[model samples]
Target: MKLFVYDHCPFCVRARIPFGLKDIPLDLGFQLNDDEETPIRMIGAKMLPILQDDGKYMGESLDIVHYLDALDGLPVFGGAPDPALVEWLEKWNDVINDLVIPRTPDPVYPEFATPEAIAYFTRKKTATFGDFDGLKARTPELIASLELGLEALVPLLPDAEGASINDILLFPVLRSLSVMDGIRYPAAVDAYRHRMAERSGVPLVSALRASC
Candidate 1:
């Protein structure tokens, strides 16, 4: 399998984490900037983290994760979670793409913000939520919403055993948010982070950081 991704895209990061956790060997193709031929050759869509297995191609990160999960014989939902629970997990995956990934940066150090990058983010931030102050003003509400989601999902997360797709899809959002100022949700985020720290997948995160 060949995985095409950029280093800092949170969607790509989320997709890659599960593969790392499962120890799935892949031929990684890293592309940081836009390539004219990539979209057409991969999925006919302008997105990172495109996965090619055999001759089949998939574009979205979640789709790629699902494909890899099936191939690796890993539980897509941790050990026979209810269908509704699985649906919710996939829903949250989309929510992460729409609501979280757009707002968060990859949680690595030596911030990758270039002048052009900053300008791009500035425009996107403004267009999405009006202005920086607007985004800041809504932080409390955002945190409250996230807390509610987390609280609702507490039952689905791993306890003494292991994490589900819920954890994989969820943690990076909080981790990415940790890098930002003025964003609160520390308790929920911290609990998840602490759990993630103790998981076997932690080394994968470490490897990813090292590679970056």
Candidate 2:
């Protein structure tokens, strides 16, 4: 089975988690930011982390996660996501996006390999996010907000015993934040991030330093 992904995408990271944790081998197709044709042809839209398996295609990150979790008749994410963690993410979603989205294309990921691809991403994202430079300038403020949120997240983090639906939902978002440096992660949350990274076999984004 092959999974087409944009490497910096948290949703793509979501789809990758199950395969990694389950010890399933998956071929990765890194889709370019400018390539709408590939996903459009596969799933009739320009969305991603599309999965191709035995001539069939699947879209949506969590759907792919659930399907893969059950593919071998044993499931890893059988429990519902922890409500506190879910609420924490919901509360901080905008802050996380503001900090992470502007930094994603800055890294040398395969999706942004070409100038056109980077331009396409920048243009599209700018429409929603205003200007990248404006966002970069607010990094200190954003990091402050994220650090507070991370502290609140500490008590909510699950123990590193088994996988839950929360792990699928939470790890990718944390991994995306790893792109930025200097935001202080609280002790439990920091350990949870590294633990989940190891368990999911998806390493944190380390290439780019914090833009602030």
Candidate 3:
């Protein structure tokens, strides 16, 4: 199996973390900012986190995670996520992708601090859920919603043990949120954030920070 990704993309980071945690042997191909053709050729879209297994290509982080989870005999939704949970997870993914990731600027790159960059991001952010301030304000609410979902998920984890999809899906968003100032979360969510920070896959986020 081979994975093609760039280090800065949160989607790619999240997709690769599960593979590493599962100890899956995979050839990694990284595309730098100037590189373009490989992604288009491999997946018919210029997207990072493209997975190729036995000549079969898959794109989109969530889809790749689901596929790999199936291959490893792990539950993609943590032992059968209910419909409501599934819906929330999907929405949660979108919220992070649209609102959080864009608002939380990369710490290492001040070039992205330009007015033009902010304008571009403002456009992308507005396309999702309207004003940036409103969307940013709702992050706590989103985290709370995730905590409610996690509360439902805690008992369903394999052996009532460690992490689940809830952790995988929410951790990166929380980490990204931490990069920003004045973002507050509930106590339970903060505790979970602490736990996720200790995971083996947590180093993968540093890979992203370096890219920035």
Per-residue lDDT tens digits of candidate 2, residues 3-49? 99988898999999888788899899999999999999999999999
Q: Each candidate: what lDDT? A: 0.57, 0.86, 0.59
**How many angstroms is residue 69 displaced in model 1 relative to the true structure, after the best TM-score fit?**
1.7
Segments of candidate 2 deviating more than 4 angstroms: 207-212
Clashes of 3: 0
lDDT of 3: 0.59
lDDT of 1 by residue, 103-210 (tens): 444434222334444455556656764655555556566666656665666655544235466655655554444444443443644566656644524322344466
Clashing pairs in 3: none
Arrange candidates by TM-score, descending: 2, 1, 3
The lDDT of model 2 is 0.86
TM-score of 3: 0.58
Please write out the lDDT profile of model 3 over residues 16-43, one tens digit for every residue: 7567556677677765443457778887
User: Candidate 3: misplaced stretches above 4 Å?
Assistant: 6-10, 26-36, 72-79, 82-101, 104-163, 203-212
Clashing pairs in 1: none
TM-score for all predictions? 0.61, 0.94, 0.58
